[model samples]
Target: MNNSNQTLTIKEQLQACRSKEETFKTLVTLSKILQRLSSEEKTDENKVKGCESAVWLIVEESNGIRHFNADSDAKLMRGVLVAILSLVEGKAAKDIQQMNLKVELAELNLSSYLTSSRTNGVLAILSQLQQP
Candidate 1:
């Protein structure tokens, strides 16, 4: 029954955010975890469409797990991308495909701070990840 033995869930940690500023700060910190794509890798083919800001994503599969590399012109979007990618990166394609990302993001309240356009952008990134 030691509270220390229990780890905080992402939802708990997210709900702990008391203010918009704090939430933004958390997002900026999360953004650091996303792997940046090199200039050459940010080609038109990798670029995610229907986004307000420029975003690029590259997916590679080796064995069964898929690897994700991504970047965004907007720091906020990058943070959002990290949150989304956290669900699928390094996971098998079948596992990722089985996930309902909108539900996951909703559980984390990750989209509460996003505008409609930004949400669509996030969805676009998800769409790219689902591609074969």
Candidate 2:
């Protein structure tokens, strides 16, 4: 288990999981965190396209740093969003724009467990975050 006081980088957190079961557990934990940030009000304007499930993303900028809030109709998709958010949330817009989310995700080794559409959904969320 990760220490509450010690913030781990996304790569470090993902690497901490040694097995598929552990990875799934980590995703579930991330999904729970996302669930707390989600709300029913984020329906129409914030909805993300290209996802098989209904996913909503709300980005709030404070002092040049972006805070991400999101939700999904599907648990797995929510988990995926959580993974994406962990890397980008609280980052500067410029940092978000410069990030190679595809490469970061590849390092997480999620492709083996996720379907093509699910992978695309994650990419779609990353695309949204990259917008100016």
Tens-place lDDT digits, model 1, residues 1-132: 111111234345566788888778877876776667789999999899999999998888889878788889888878777666666767788887888878877766675677898888888888778766
Each prediction's whole-model lDDT (CA): 0.75, 0.74
Off by over 4 Å in 1: 1-12
lDDT of 2 by residue, 30-124 (tens): 67766444465566789888887888888888899888778888776777676777777677899989989888777775665578887677778
Model 1 poorest ten-residue lDDT run: 1-10
> Which residue pairs overlap in candidate 1's backbone?
none
Evaluated against the true structure, the overall lDDT of model 1 is 0.75
Q: Name the TM-score of candidate 1.
A: 0.85
Off by over 4 Å in 2: 1-10, 36-40
Q: Summing lDDT over every window of 10 consecutive residues in candidate 2, give the lowest-scoring window.
A: 1-10
- Screening candidate 2 with a backbone cut-off below 3 angstroms (N, C-alpha, C), the clashing residue pairs are none
Task: Evaluate residue 46 in candidate 2 and report its C-alpha lDDT on the 0 to 100 scale.
Answer: 91
